[model samples]
Target: MGRIVGIDLGTSTSEIACIVDGTPKLLPNSQGKLVTPSVVHIGEDGGVLVGEAAAEYLFTRPDCTFMEVKRLTGGGEVLKAHGKEYRPEEIQALLLGYLVRCAEESLKEKIERAVITVPAYFTDLQRRATAKAGELAGLAVERILNEPTAAALDYGLANLKECKNVLVYDLGGGTLDVTVLELFEGVIDVKASCGNNHLGGKDFDEIIMGRLAEPSDSADPSADERALMRLKKAAEDCKIALSTREEYQVSLPFLLTGAEGKPLSVEKTVRREDFEDWVAEKVNSTREPMMSALADAALTPGDLQVVLLVGGSTRIPCVKKLVEETLGTVPRSLVDPDLTVARGAAIQAGLIEGSINNEDLVLTDVCPYTLGTAPLQHGIFGRRVFFDPIIPRNTTIPAEKSKIYHPAVDYQTEVTIDVYQGESSDPANNERLGELNLSGIPPAKVGKESVEVSFSYDMNGILQVKASVLSTGRQVSAEISTTGIKAKAPLDLSRWEEAEGARKFRPLIRKAEKLMAAGGDPGGDVELLVRRVKEALLLKNTKEAGDLRDQLLGMLEALEQLLQLQDDRTLGIDRP
Candidate 1:
């Protein structure tokens, strides 16, 4: 058996880490960098390119290349670029496949049994899509942890060893997640959570791109489009550069293209202050949400002992300054802010594999929002439809919750069901997660009929829904449809049996074999990690060293079978 690897499948950058002995450690890429850009390029023939190579092609191959993919996680239209359309899930799997391969190569072992992280605000469809991406990549995704919760775990294991209340402020590349965690004895309890799925670093990039766009002129639309893209890329570079230096220079060498399709190169130097000012609006949006999450958790800024920041966007001086100004205390820099979530996820994997003693650690998470369904309640204007919440916000996961509904009219023989996911009372305002219809009931006075609606959400955030007529055992069913993260719309199995996309993604069967050959596939940077794990365990602290030894052996063995085929159906692994 081998160790279980933890992955932060982030929107902008992805990272993997593992626990050695009793401590968490980051697994670096071949470049010796902890974070790998979650970007990928699909060649004309479908051979995939990932990481730095893929990032390099972003500007050069704008058409065929896909980035900022986490934007389209659920069922939505595929994005078009470089004259090609891409389903978000497909592109995501490609990225996951690359990371899985990198993990195997780095560790020189068979890698299996991974704990992957997702945004707290991801809808059911979105979560399912993420899971499918892991399946396609060939890793047995043991659990899908929330990103903010993972950050809290990192804080719990490393800094907040003593019982204390903490808040995790995670503003990443594509979403914002705020979680309140309390450390009691050894448990890391997430009291409350909230976030904006459409906000974060990519929004900052778009803001700069908007500001850099050349003023529109009716006569030359093509010129403006070319100039804008060139300037936008240049502005983004300057933004990233300024974070590390007092000031940075930007060169938009091809601000505008000539009649022969040649580009005009322009240059500019940007100061940190100026760039921050340009992005102030994007940065300010975090304030309201931070305050809202505080209100929801019934805490004020003064109540927090430690405010942990997680994500690459937090590296910006302005972003850090704003948080400090609001909380009146600088956040602790104990964890490599960028790798904290991945480290936390790996720590969780260790616990799940029974390698680490969880007697001291319990992670209690909340449902970020409400789950409901749309049904006609009245016939004011020919059957008025509205949302009825089943499970309210902030409920714990791996939880079973149910709500009962009764007939609205006399002699009703049929009932319409429209399942929804969101906090709004209006069905239109919330996303239609799924729906079904129930029939074949004894025609009785509508007020005499009854139905039981139940929903069970597993720890991984996958959902199971059930609706049964009490009088008649009559029911219908539907599961959150997930063909891949790249699916633009749910492919109806009956109508779309061909499944061109489904057959295209190769099952990770063979890759699992190579992964198993490696003793412990710890993901990328495994070679250095093996050395680090050994050094950490040899520490003079007897108790800590013993804990690490047990954890390491457990992870090593589990990692071995994670690549092998398991016969258990309930665990959700596929047969060879």
Candidate 2:
């Protein structure tokens, strides 16, 4: 039995840790750095490179180097490198293998098992993909621990005797997760978790990129992969620098060639205030999830004893301010945000392998999403399919719940149990996990034949559904298989045509679009505001859309004035 380790496989970076003398300690990578860039590069010589070494290739060999593959986990999208196609998990496996080898070298012993952490809101397919990546890295995965839960475990281990409600706000490079849990007498019971998988620090970097590239309209810099990579790196640097300083000078010389075949550059001074303004909406977006988590936990902000901050994104001043304002308490970063999740993972590994006593620390988690079957229901519109939740979101894990449903039509001999995962009332609006056909339901009146569906979600977040025909005593079961599943498409908003208030936004939306097309707005502010307005409309959030509409009108006026001023200056006409 080799040693078990803990790993945080993150979007921007990854880390490995282990328990030593009952304390979780991070292990430095091959380069002796505590955190490794989650970047992979395939060399022309057929060798694979990861971490900081591979990060350099991202600039020179952008085609062969891949970063941020974590965002694509569990999707069927294929990544091409060195004339070969690789799945997202395979790319992650390379990073994992590199980390494990480095750890083995440092410890002078083999590590055979690991407890890896993912966002609390990761889906069943994503979890399975992460587990597969671990297996490919040649380790037996002990558990797929939620990142926030792991952070809570790390904190709870050190405060075993305390009884208090805690909240973990984790905003990393590519995701945001808000979790509420209770800690009492060595027990860590999670209440709820909520998050947006598509939001985080990377988004902030993009804001900076847009700001930096605003001055250059002669060419599309994004068309050049190498140029885009350089700009991305510079944007990230600017973001990090502005964290401490009020302003940072972004100087990217010869970034790309202009339409006229001349080298173009990007030189600008980015103020922290401006950056915050640009990202305010995104930062504030975390509020809803935070409030939702607290509500699900049945705890108010005043009830929280401590708020823990995890992930690098929390280092942002605006992000911190938002958390403080929303939670009414300053978040504590006692453990390094960049390192906490991995440390917690290490603690979990310790508990599993007996490095730490199970009696001294116990942890329990919850399902982050709702799981249910779609059954026919009699509604005002006659018979329609509605989602019937078997296990609602935030319910304690390793939980099982069953529901009884009858056949929809008389003499129906079979019933197909369509399982879904989401909160939408319509099954079509949610993700369809899989379906089980329970045949042999002896033909009888619709009300006479009944089928009972059982959903069992485990500690790992995997779902197993079983359907039984009561009278026939026949059964069918299936573990939802998401292997090679295609990535989900963006929410369909085509039905917005018939939405009640959607008509009112068309003229405003059209005006914003025209202003954006006029292309005088430099900071990309006009574009950002317009996109947000459209998003609000898509969500049928009339209130938010209305508010954004007013903002967009004001922004358009300001942009027009700025553009007019620029034209006047270009024409050598000065106005008092």
Candidate 3:
């Protein structure tokens, strides 16, 4: 019954907005700025500080300040500052609560719910962590909207009747996302999205830090943590200046102490040309996501009517130029890049709250990752495992897909369907979301026992998997969720790099993929060994991993021999 605004909970900055008089407007903070920094601090007295006040402690009290909390959203890392431990979600809550207070003061209404925006490529865990942060702030989260999708909403609201395909290129403070969307006849459908969370303005800041450090002979200015934080601040300022001017001079008084024991004042005059050169690689990296999005949308540069730019990082001149060169089209800035997501979120909140006309505002999104289950089968060596994709990446959200698999062994009475999300053909290379185990299956022949696994991915990115035995009608289900609303503790990834072996075993994987691509296989007995090795690695069994590795390698050599034989046969040449 109260006001529900939209919140763009970003990595480097955060903002809130609401629809007033059928127009979405941003709510400014106490500092009179529409955008608020996402930085958090723990005061000496253990008081929680946020936004501008928190930024004041960045250099002097680097130990008490926390930046880039967004990167820890779904992970299990705690910030120990000022003799206090704070979870990433807790720090975010402080910032969100500040925004809520700002909104309530500006609107003179008690805000209860909000629609928050995150990166399109965020996992279900990450999305839920955002909602948990909102809950910690005492606000009911209306929904978790993707950042690019939110930006598209802001773009679509203006051109409701236009039939055009638009690409959303969002390069923000802490992440970069490219989304392809088509708007026609009051509908906005997201075709594809790709991004890297570790890439953005923050990385550019680091490059600036390195550039500024090149001249320092007194000491490695970045050697001390405090000095590094100070340099980081300087880097940010230098970056903002280079965006508009050909050159900018930065002088930090007493940045470090020289070998002579006197204070070292660092000064550097950076040319925009040089700045762009350092950042050119970072900017170029975004090109991959743009192409990936284009391919996923099944469109070309000529197919797009407009290229929309969103987020503060998009303001950089180099970023703009790179996008134009790659997309072969200039960016269309109908909305402010920095404020677009929050404004779009406000529009979403308004639509949900019935404060604006939204009957024509139909928006459809997609699952950013492939969803499937691990099923076992018989192979030449032994039992083989495969990761069959059920709901593929970029498939429309609020979508459900199912695939049927039969038991591998005769007289099997129980079955387990381990769910995973990724693009890898090998299930072992994917992320395990959850699993469903069903019992009481009718004892039958290997091919006769049938089981169906269904994956339902909603717009919020949560996945619900249901499994059933066809013969006995036995069923089981599980939903992968976080400490959603009531905001409890979170879950930890079993072993983050257990799949590091996947990278080391790339050659073998490629060989298997090539063999499968050739069609009509089964000449080699390697699938079973590969499956065993993957299972062992996934279980973090080092001994088993080593043993399986040996087995897989030997079999791989045989498979390579078999491949050579196939090549000889295809050429109609007699073997030596």
Candidate 4:
């Protein structure tokens, strides 16, 4: 059997890594590219292509291609692209299939199990959706590891320390996760975690691009779209450039159409100083939140042994500086900022498969948000709690916690229990998950009766909610149903199956001969790129994976289209 893989299924790009022999090794795709684009193409022939090939051909063949499908996750709404609406699961599946195939090729065998990682703050449904994606991709998911927890494992292995308090600041492509972990005697204990699903490195890139790109007030819509796309692309290029260079320039082009509908062009330039000055405020905004987390844990920055950084965004010089300035110390850089979680996850997968023993290693994870229910008096007074959390944020998971409540009125036969998952006291300010109806309650005087409400978040990040009427001893327990978010409109996948049926699997092989023939190694960051592709491939819910695959592909296709013209060009350019 092929070895189980560890995946960092990122928002912008995904990665994969696995334990081979006694050391962890990264895997590359057929293109020999380290990180495969988390993209999927719906070909004109009704076939599907995932990874670099799909991404490369997206802009060159936009009519049938779909990309950036991950945005549709938890959307509960169908997305329209290439004249068809796709469900999230289907999109994710395609990406997973591509990854599994890549792994099979590498090991020259079948792989059936894996340890997949998710954002620390992903909701119950999102977690389920992720696991379902894995199932669709044809692997038995051994476990779902939190991204920060995985990073901690990596840290633990490298340090081999006796005990210490380490904070993991995981800033990924689409989300920001801050976790406080206590590492001691082979056990990794999670104290707390906080995150925002809407925030991450992508937001940073967009903010930089949005500020630098010039607006076009042209009458042609298509021209406007193409121009704006270039502007954003230019913004992204500048952001990447600034990461490595002291300064970078973005040229804003003005396309002027002649009388015969031909075009003329003009250019303007933007420097790194102007770019930094514009984004400084955005960069500083994260400080207060980081401080708040420390405050909650009752620990000053000086209390930490290390402020370990994870995620590709940490590559930004400004980010690193800001974090150091905030903490008053230089943070540790033991793992590659982008590949930390992927490697940690791979290490854990190895232990689970007995390739690496758990005799001296243990890991713990925490909840990222608060979980609770509506106040007893508020509902009686016509007050509604939206996302009142029963479980407070950062509580350790796979551990049980509970709170008690009393009856609000006399002679009440049925009680309404509105459950929520967030930190705000006001329900309207939080996310209203669902409510429970506790029936058959014995009629009682006001404040004469009570119920014990319990919440349990498991290692997989799934929540189990329960309520027991103390007086009657009646109880109910359930894994909270996350049907609150509507499912996406289902797309017919028959065409995809038919296409696969007709095609023979063309495997990617890189023997010594092939590598030597390639003239040299694949290039810089080849290992990092390979790891990203493997991580993305291990994500398997067919529908969601398929959708994410489509979205990522679409994004890459858009970029490829902009990058296709072979000319003297810098990475960052403002097109519009």
Please, what are the lDDT tens digits per residue for candidate 4 over residues 340-361?
Answer: 7878888889888878778778
TM value for model 1: 0.78
Per-model TM against the reference: 0.78, 0.83, 0.79, 0.76
- What TM-score quantifies how close candidate 2 is to the native fold? 0.83
Per-residue alpha-carbon lDDT of model 3 for 1-576, expressed as tens digits?
888999999888999999989888999998889988998888888787789889888877888888889988877898888667888898888889999998999988899899999999888778878888999999999888989999889888887888889999999988999999899976999999988878889999999998787645768775788988988888999999988999999888888877888887778899999999988888899999999989999999889888888888888999998889988865476778989999889989988998877787888999877888778766898877788889988999899988888877766766767777777878888877666667655555667668888888887887887777664344567776553222112212234235756567667656765765765246323444454455456546667767766776776677678778888999998887
Clashes of 4: 54
Worst 10 residues of 2 by lDDT: 484-493
Candidate 3, residue 222: how far the Cα is off, in Å: 4.9
Ten-residue stretch with the least lDDT total in model 3: 484-493
Residue-wise C-alpha lDDT for candidate 2, range 436-472, written one tens digit per residue = 8776555566687678899999988888888876753
Question: Which residue runs of candidate 3 sit more than 4 Å off their true CA positions?
Answer: 214-223, 258-265, 377-384, 410-414, 439-445, 482-576
- Give the total clashing residue pairs for model 1: 36
Superposition error at 313 for model 4 (Å)? 1.3
lDDT of 3 at 87: 83
Question: Of the candidates shown, which would achieve the greatest TM-score relative to the real structure?
Answer: 2
Off by over 4 Å in 2: 215-217, 330-333, 484-576
